[model samples]
Target chain A: MVGAGHAGLAMSRCLAVRGIDHVVLERGEVANSWRTERWDSLRLLTPNWQSRLPGFGYEGDDPDGFRDMTQTVAFLQRYAEVISAPVETRTTVTSIRRDDEDYLVTTDRGEWRARSVVLASGACNLANVPKVADALPDGIASVHSFDYRNPDQLPAGGVLVVGASATGTQLGYEIHKSGRPVTLAVGEHIRVPRTYRGRDLMWWMDNAGVHDERWDEMDDINRARRVPSFQLTGTDDGSTLDLNAVTDIGVALVGRFAGLVDGKAQFSGSLLNQCALSDLKMNRLLNSFDEWAAEVGADADVEPSHRLDSTRVPEKPPLTLKLAEAGIGTVLWCTGYRPDLSWLEVDVLDRKGRICHEGGVTSSPGLYLMGMQFLRRRKSALIDGAADDADDLSEHLAAYLDG
Target chain B: MSEATVNNGVNADALVAAREALTEAPQAAQFNWRASCEWKNGTHSHSTVEGFFGLGEEQKRSKTFAFDADHPEIFASEDLGATPVEYVLVGLASCLTAGVAAIAQYRDIQLKSVKATIEGDMDIQGILGIDDEVRNGFDGIKVTYEIDADAGRDDIEALVAQSQKRSAVYDIVTNPTAVTVEVK
Candidate 1:
């Protein structure tokens, strides 16, 4: 198996239950990324009920069922032990080679041969920062959302958040509340309520019934080919931070920072437009909340038809910025991240340097990949929802073994 | 947002040159995702072989396309299951599997079928919700590589490293990105 992470350990558990012989290799300790890399405030967006493998349930105190980052790692560690997963921690694989009728995996620890290999290394290994970020003044400190542990780690001055996605929004709220002047860059963000109609997002997800669903119920494959919009209002743990609380807290709202010309931070674009977009999404989310409320037979807290006064972002220019000129000392890039598959010295990849696979099947006959952001399902990437992907993929692997 | 790419000309060359200069300059300006450490510094940089640069030779992609609500499911939205992240996985898996085929062809190993699968976990509240307390992207992703080759386990595992996909999208994603924010 690949790196023993959330997906990897879960896959190992599924395999163990089925009495399948598989080895899980991890560069760090078991569930190390979840334990070490995630922020202290991190929690599962999906509730406790959603983070289960085929035979395991998140049997904890609260069926409200959301867990913090620590709880998550603890659970995964315990699960790894429960199933006796054959995981080798701190054994980073250097290369994967194919010999006569089998596969050989090289790692720092040692070498191992197997009939198949599972790369459970998920997407977090790569931290994506923009090239332009380096253009800022060195005097000003800048950090990605990954490194942000608390507001204390941030500078005393106000912060400018580049991305308006969930991390951007969450960090913006927390840091702003900490009395730091926080400014959030307006990106196209998908707004979903933490509690829709007084129910958790996971409940709504289950009600949507897309989990363990037929692929066709989703949009057509051709339609699925498009990329996704960035999201802004989901929860990290069971609790979702409400943006409504943000503007009330006096965080400086900003437009996309236009190019920093000659070190003077230039800000263009109508900040008001971003407000309008937020209004639209909030309106939509409110409507969704109302619908959910109706589903659960309850009254809605937010009225769907209510409109509010907001500004529009100027069309002439995206928001522009210069670190020194604007007195902006710190920038937090909430922009998204990509994969780190460079060390993988295999060739099933494409000319464009992407792995070729369909529904988890690589171009190579027996090579496989799992646990990507939305790897197999609309819900596959969520913390609580990953086990579903692991179970499904494990079944497929078992099938191949039987064959 | 509209997608943009500078390719196959002085524009692309200048872009690379400008990106390379970013490593030394510590300003958080634009996002640089190149896999080579010749452009190093950030903890986000590919420092280890597992880091960005150790992946593979760069693949100079010449094209990019934008996606939106109109055609939301193609590379962005998770409508029919697949996502840009999944595409990245496919790209990685595909790269390594192709490497397997290449190695087998080069070594005269018996020709046989090969397949691989990958998976990742991302912070939903961070990526999906409009909250800024969380990070914008995934915390850490896990990839599972499966191989079916006629070669022995050692040979196949070694060849898997030959994949260009690891260096391209995966490496780029793994690197740290910088951006500027303006507050009014």
Candidate 2:
């Protein structure tokens, strides 16, 4: 097994419970990405209750509580201790290949053979800071979502968070709270409920079969890409939590990051155009709930005090207050990152820099991928759901190990 | 330096020769399809990229079609995982060859097959950064074309030198392109 995050730990624990002996290989310290890349204030969207491995669930004062980056890093470290999972840290896997009966895994430290391998390393490997952005006037401070930890790290200036996806929106909210002037460069987004009003939306999605394999295989790449925005609360127990309310307070909303020209940062587009997209998605979700409620003979009249209207929003640049006069100082590239598979020399990856895979299996057999974001469910990327993902990949590993 | 040869620029014959050759053209071929477009979203969304080009379009746009989307543990999302830019890049690569093939049929130039590969680099940092000053779109795009034709290199170049498959995406990628954005 390669990697030691929630996916790797869950797989190892499942094996221990199943009485399967397997080896797990990690390139950095356990949960290294979570330990390193995550911003200091970062908190899991899923509560602590959901942060479980197969044989064990979190046992702490706050079952529903959410754990911040430190807590998560500590939790995974403790998990490794508890299960006595055979893990080697600071050992980067340099090459991977397959023989008839066994798979060969290589790292800077050593080469080892396993009957099967689990690529439990999550997708954080690729931190795609744009090449061109690096060439910008070095006077301005900039950072990717990965390197950003707290407000202290940013330059003392107004910030622009580009891309209105979760990262953009969430980070924009965080920085704004720091009392820094902030603007959110907006784009298309699908805003599902944190919960249907109050109840955990994942519960409905799970019970309604949102986690099924088929949901991952939906024909509408458009729809599948629209990962549901789940409840960021902890379970009934309140130890775990997400501070959505904290984020809403300080965010400055704007339109697409059209360009930066002259002394001013330029952003102009239809917020209504985008909100229309989000509004349609919201309606689709509500409609789905309504249809389900009707089928179950349940009422569907519940609605938020605030209703969304595509037309109500302004079309001009969405800056809370226009900064058209002054030169925009810094750009917080919350735009997102791309995978760096350069070290993994494999032809399986297409020209687009991706490996071809079906479910968890890569085009090359014996080489399996796990904990991929949106790999199987939208939840694959979420720590709360990575346990199930580990098990899903473990089954395949067992086949490889057993056979 | 040599008197005439070193001092002289290209002869008028060379310029005229190039233009005449471009105009010679292959036989004409026509393709007809009643297609209409509905722009419901930005860059490339809501719309499904189908038909053919490059390697080929997947019947479904599962996260699996693009390497970056599936390996989220590794790659971050650009358009919130909508893979539109991926669709656009693949479309240009595939359509250009298809453009050549249709022209081949129209011109009665026997063409065996056509395939192409394309890649584009974008400055996502500009989009994410405060200095909206950085270029947000692709910095440069390169396409390598491989064709098996009844005619040789000269024929394929003649066909591709003037093909309609060079659509908006291709034009923007090849030429100077900018989006005007101000306070208004």
Evaluated on chain A only, model 2 obtains a TM-score of 0.84
- Top candidate (lDDT): 1
Indicate the worst ten consecutive residues by lDDT in candidate 2 chain B: B26-35
| TM-score (chain B) of candidate 2 | 0.50
Per-model CA lDDT versus the true structure? 0.61, 0.60
Quality class of the docking in candidate 2, CAPRI style: incorrect
| lDDT, residue B144, candidate 1 | 54
Give the least accurate 10-residue stretch of model 2 chain A, judged by summed lDDT: A238-247
Fnat for candidate 2 (0 to 1): 0.00
Whole-structure CA lDDT of model 1: 0.61
RMSD of each: 20.5, 19.3
Give the DockQ of candidate 1: 0.02
